[model samples]
Structure formats: C-alpha cells, structure tokens
Target chain A: MNQRLKLFWAGVRAEFPLLIGVFPFGLIYGALALSSGLSATAAQMMSSIVFAGSSQFVTAQLVHGAAPGLVIVLTIAVVNLRHMLYSASVAPYVRNLSMRWKALLSYFLTDEAYAATIIHYEEEELTPASHWFFLGAGLSLWFTWQVSTAFGIFLGTSIPESWPLDFALPLTFIAMVVPVLKDRPVIAAALSAGLVALLAFSLPYKLGLILAALTGIIVGMLLEGKESPKEAL
Target chain B: MNIWLVMLLGGLITFGMRLSFIYLLGRFEVPETMRRALRFVPPAVLSAIVFPEVLMPSGKFDFGLDNHRFLAGIVAVLAAWWTKNTLLTILAGMAALLILQLVL
Candidate 1:
C-alpha cells in the first residue's frame, strides 16, 4: 500500500476504541433529537453542522424547551469554546500547511479526532504525515457519526414514546463528567458547579447553566493556579 | 428566533471557535491562565449541566429516595469511576433509572 494509506490506517487503528465509545453517543443524539421534535433533516444536518457531541445534545435540549435562537446559539458557542484549546495545541504542528489545509482540518477537529491526531503527532513527530493521520481519524469519525445518526433517526421513529430515552442525555453526561474527577481541583469544580446549578436552576433561558459553568471554571482555575504557579503565568 | 436560524448561527459560532487559535497562531499568544482555565472547562461545564438534570428533575429540588435520577446518577458516577468506560456508565445509569422508576 501507499504511504498515505498506511498513515490513514494507522490513524484508524488508534481511533477505533474511541469510535466504539462515540457510536452509542451518535445514536442517542439522533434518537433524542427526534424525540425532541426535530425533523430528520434537522437531526442529520446537526450532526454535520454542529458536529460536536455534547453541544449538539445541549442544543437539542434548548431547542425543545423553545429557547430563543440567540440563547441556543450562545450556549453552543460557550460549550464549544474548548475547541480553541485544541486548535492551539495543534497549531504549531500544522503551521506550514496551506490555508485550505488548515480550514479543512479545523472542520474535522472534534474530540475524538483531536485525541487520536494529537497523540499521533506527539508520538511520531512526523513533519507532514501527521496531517494524513488527522485526516484519517477525522474522516472516520465523520463517516461514523453521519451513519449512526441516520440510523438513530430511523430507529427513533419506531421506538415507543413510553421508553423514556430522553433521560439518557443526563445519564450520558454523568458518565462523561464522573470519570474525569481525578483530583482536588477537578472535584471542587464538579461539586461547586453542581451546587450552583441546583441553586440557579430557576433562571430563565438556561442562563443558570452558563453561570454555573463559569463559576466552576473559575474555581478550578484558581485551585489549580495555587498548585502550579507556572500555569498561572 | 427560528430554529433553523439558531442552528445556523450556532454552527457559525462553533466553527469560529474551532478556527480561532489556528487562524491567529502566528499573530497572538494564548495566556497561560486562559489555558489553565480551559483545562477545567470540560469537567466544570459538564457537571454544571449534569447536576441540575439529576438533582432537579422538575422545577424543584428532590434529593430523597423518590428521586430516581439522583439515585441513578450516583450509580452512573460509580460505574464511570470504576470502569472508566463511558458506554458502561451510561448503560448502568439508564438501567438503574428504569428500574427505580418502575419500583418507586
């Protein structure tokens, strides 16, 4: 096989495990989006347009609640702000690439793609082939997401309304956030955010979520700063 | 106010964020504090959302045994912590919630 194919397959192999985790999420998103009253086209388009999983889930929730368009748009912006970090992390590695290459890769920079691609770039330290690795990982995820979402939309129409699958959204989040609680700052962040969210739940347009998230972020940053002054600099 | 417009703008904002640092890499530097803060963004934001959903299912708080979401959320947290498996945690929580709702 050619070098490009080799790099692509290597990327695929590294991302396979993550893809397993992501498949269920895509399916759930599709099903929940439908249950939340989105048309099939809207549900499918969301997978491509927004492309981020958690934000897409939150968007479906806000849309279902009949939130103003601006509010939902703002929420999506805040939720996806972390991507800027990923962009920075990978920027130096791909600096030499053309603007078109940068644009294409940016479009594919979801969590799974970033995880696999960054690890590949760090490990291989390859000057250009890392781009191929990113392409492979990203295209694989993009393909899987589209197909799984379509399947979910089709399956969602058949499932009974009594199933209560919407609860899966929060459950999915619990699963995600719980494992990441590895240390004091992270735990503090989670606990503080949870408490504030409870207190602020009555806020309109889900502004409470934004406030709660900011509070947690600040608390975590402060705690972390004390431990690592270099990080504070 | 239209749903489509919301999605379109959301998509645009999302794309912009993803493009932000990459577009400005040579021209700017991300502050160290901002980078550290970004580290906490995921855990903080996710928990902020999760807590309200599990603890306050309706308009009010419910922390007692009758709160199936809270109980199931605890189960999911334990599963995630022990297994480090997202799928397993979700499945366990969903199953637990289903059972709790049926029983109570």
Candidate 2:
C-alpha cells in the first residue's frame, strides 16, 4: 500500500479505541437533543454543524429550556475556543500544505482528531503522509458522529423520558476535564472557573458561562506567568 | 434564528478559530505568554461549564447533601485524578449520581 494509506490506517487504528467511548456519547447527545425539544433534523444537523460534543450537549440542554439562540451560539463558541490551541499545536506540522488541504483538515478538526493527530505528529516527524493520518482520524469521527446522532434520534423516540440520561453529559465533561488538572495552573484555572460560574449563575442568557470561562483562562494565564517567566518567554 | 442558521454560524466561527493560527503560522508566532495560557484553556473552559451544571442545576446555586451532582462530580474528580482514565471517570461519576439520586 501507499505511504498515505499506511498513515491513514495508522490514524484510524489510533482513533478506534477512543471512538468506542465517543460512540455512546454521540448517541446520548442525539436522544437528549431530541427530548430537549430539538426536531430530528435539527439534532442531526447539529452533530455536523457544531461538531463539538460537549457544546452540543449544552446547546441541547439550553434549547430544551427555550433559551435564546444567541446564547446557545455564544456558548458553543466559548466551549470550542480550545480548538484554537489545537490548531496552533498542529499548525507547524501541516504548515507546508496548500490552503485547500488546510481548509479540509480544519473542517475535520475535532477533539478526537486533534488528540490522535497530535500524538502521531509528535511521535513521527512530519511527512506528506502525516496529513492523511489526520484525515483518517477526523473522517472517522465525523462519520461516526453523524451515524450516532441519527441513532440517538431514533432511540430518543423510544427511550422513556425519565431515564435521567441528561446527567451523563456533565459526567462526560468531568471525565474530560478532571484528568487534565495535572498542575497548579490547571487546578487554579478549574477552581476559579467553577467559582465564577457559581457566583455568576444568575446572569442571563448563560452569559455567566462565558464570563466564568474567560475569568478562569485569564487566571490560569496570569498564574502561569507568575510561576515561570522562563516558560512564558 | 433557525437552528440551522445557528449551527451554520457556529460552525463557521468554530472553523475560523481553528483555522486562524494554522493560517497565520510562520507569518507570526504565538506569544509565549499566550502559549502558556493556551495550556489552561481546556481545564478552565470545561470546569467553568461543568461547575454550574453540577452546583447550579436549576440555574441557582445549591449546596449541601442534596446536591447529588456536586457529590458525584467530586467522585469523578477523584476517580479521574487517581486513575487518569476518562471512561472510568465517566462511569464512576454516572454511577455515583444514579445511586445518589435513588437514595435521596
């Protein structure tokens, strides 16, 4: 097989384990979005349109309560702002590619894709085949997301309303976030964000979330700056 | 706004953010301070979102034993910190929440 195919398959292999976990979450999002008052079409489209898992779950929750569309949109943007970091991390590896390739890869970028591709990029130096690995990981996630969303929509119609599955969404976020609190800056950021969120919970349109997140980010940055000017410089 | 419109705009913004640094690389370098700041983005943003969900389930702050989500979330944090396993953390948290809800 060609080098690109080899890298693509390698990417797929690396992502396969992660997908097992993600598949169920996607299905849950689908069912929850529908039960939360989104039409089947809307729920399905959201899987592709927003593509970020946690944000989608949050959007579904807010929509269920009839929150304004603007709030949902802003929440989605904030939740996904971390993608910029991933973009920067991976940018150097793929910088040689044409604009078209960058555009295609950017569209496929998701947490899973970034996780798998970044590992590969770091482990194996950049090569023409490296982009193919990202393509494979991203496309797999994209395809699985769409299919799982559809399944969730179908399953949502049948699952009883009292299952309390909505809790899983937050649980998933905890799973993702808690493991990352490896150092003081990360811990401080999380604590500060959580405190701000509680204090600002009364804010309208879920603006508290944005404020809380920004506050946390700023806090974390400042703390890191204080700790290590060498690292910062 | 329609759901699709919201999604389209959200998707566009998301794509723009992701593309921004990728497109700008070499033309400019990310500031060192910002690079350090970026490391905190995931923890900060995710915790900001998660805290309110567990502590303020009904859009108001809740504390004490009645806050099952808060308790479960703590369980999740411990499990995640100890194990460093995403799936395990999620399962433990969900299970804790379910049991807590049942008991209370």
Candidate 3:
C-alpha cells in the first residue's frame, strides 16, 4: 500500500477511540435539535453547516428558547473560540500543505479531530504523509457526525422525553478532560474555571463561560509561571 | 436572524477561526503568553461546560442529594480520575444518574 494511505489509516485508527465519545454526542445533538424546534432540514444540515458539537447543542437550546439569530451566531462563535488555539497549535505542522488541503482539513477541525490529530502531529516527527493522517481522522469524524445526526433525528421520535440523555454531553466532556488533569496547573485551571462558571452562571448570553475560561487560563498561566520554567521552554 | 442565516454565519465564523493561524503560516507566531495560555484551553473550557451541566442540571442551581446529575457527576469525576478511561467514566456517571433517578 502507499505510504500516504498507510499514514491516513493510522490517523483514522488513532481517532477511533475518540469517536466512541463523540457518537453519543452526535445522537444527543440530533435529538435535542429537533426538540428545540429546528426543522428536520435545519437539524441535519447543522452537522455540515456549523459542524461543531458543543456549540451546535448550545444553538439548539437557544433556538428552543427563541433566542435571536444574532445572539445564537455570536454565542456559537464564542463557544468555538477555542478552535483558534487548536489552529495555531497545528498551523506549523501543516504549513507546507496546499490551500485545498488546508481548507478541507480546517472544516473538520472539531474538538475530537483536533485532539487526535494534534497528539499525532506532536508525537510523531514530521513525515511527508502526516497531513494524510490528519485527513483520515477529520474525514472519518465528519462522516460519523453526519450519519449519527441523521440517525438521531430519525430516532428522536421514539426516544422517551423523560430520559435525561442530555446529561451525556457533559459526561463526554468529563471523559475528555479528566485524563489530561496531570498536574497542578491543569487541575487549578479546571477547578478555577468550574467555580467561576457556577458563580457567574446567571450571566446573560453565557458570557460567564467565556469569562470563566479566560480567568482559569490566566490563573493556570500565572501559577505555572511562578512554579517552574519547565512549561515555558 | 433566520435559521439558515444563523447556520451560515456560524459556519463561516467557525471556519474562519479554524483557518486563522493556518492561513497566517510563516507570517505570525503565537506569542509566548498566549501559547502558555493555550495549554489551559481544553481543561478550562471543558470544565466551564461540565460544572454548569452538573450544578445546573435543571437550568438552575441546585446543590443537594436530589440533584441527581450533580451527584452522578461526582461519580463520573472520580471514575475519570481513577480509571482514566473515557468509556468507563461515562458509563459510571450515566449509570449513577439513571439509578439515582429511579431510586429517588
């Protein structure tokens, strides 16, 4: 087999584990979007359109509440603001790829894709086919998201309304974040951000979340600065 | 303000952010402060989301045994910390919530 395809397969394999967490999320998003008053068309298209998980869920909830379109758009943007960090981190690795590759990969840069791809990029030295690996991960996820969303939309009708399935979303986040809490700074970042989120929960437009995240980042950075130069270099 | 319009604008902005640094390429380097801060992004952001979901399971704050999600979330946190397995953590947490709701 070709080296590029081999690397692509490797990327897909590496991302397979993360997909376990995402599958339920796509289903939940699909179910919630329909319940949130979105048309079946809008609900399914969002998997391709916004193409984000958490933000899509938030958009559905806001739509259910009759939030203005601009507010939903702005909230989606803020919720996804973290993607810029992922972009900057992976930018150098894929800098040499063509514009077509960059644009296509960028569309699939969801939290799951970024988590898998970034780890692959950082751990494995630059290889000629590394970008293909990224493509494999991103494309596989895109396909799963679309399919799972459609399945959820179809099943939303029979799924009992009493089920607290929405809680699954945060459970996935728990799975994602917990393994990474290896040190003081990361732990502090999580704890501080969580506290602030609760304290500022009443903030309009969910500004509290953005504020809490920023504060936690600053706290983690400052604490890391004081303790060790180990992180900076 | 239409759904399609909202979707389009949201899609464009999301794509823009994902493309921002990649497009800058050789021209811009992420600053040291921002670079350091970025390390905290996942933990900070995820925690910000998780805390509210657990504490505000009903879309409002409730800190008691009756808050099934909050209680189950603690189970998930412990499961995630101990097992460090995504599937296990989610299973443990969800099981706890479902059982709690049934028993309560």
For candidate 1, lDDT tens digit of each residue in B1-104?
A: 87778778888888888878888888889877778888788888888888888888876889999988889989988998898888898899989988998988
lDDT of each: 0.86, 0.85, 0.87
Which 10-residue window in model 3 chain A sums to the lowest lDDT?
A: A224-233
Docking level of model 3: medium
Residue pair clashes in candidate 1: none
The runs of at least 3 residues in candidate 2 whose Cα sits more than 4 Å from the true structure, single-residue gaps closed, are none
lDDT of 2 by residue, B68-100 (tens): 888988898888878776678878888898899
Q: Give the candidate number with the greatest TM-score.
A: 1
Please state the error at residue A25 of candidate 1 in Å. 1.1
CA lDDT of A215 in candidate 2? Answer: 88
Per-model C-alpha RMSD: 1.5, 1.6, 2.3
Best DockQ goes to which candidate?
1
CAPRI class of candidate 2: medium
Cα lDDT of model 3 by residue, A160-231, tens digit:
988877777788788878998888988999999999999998888777888888888988998898899775
Better of 1 and 2 by TM-score: 1
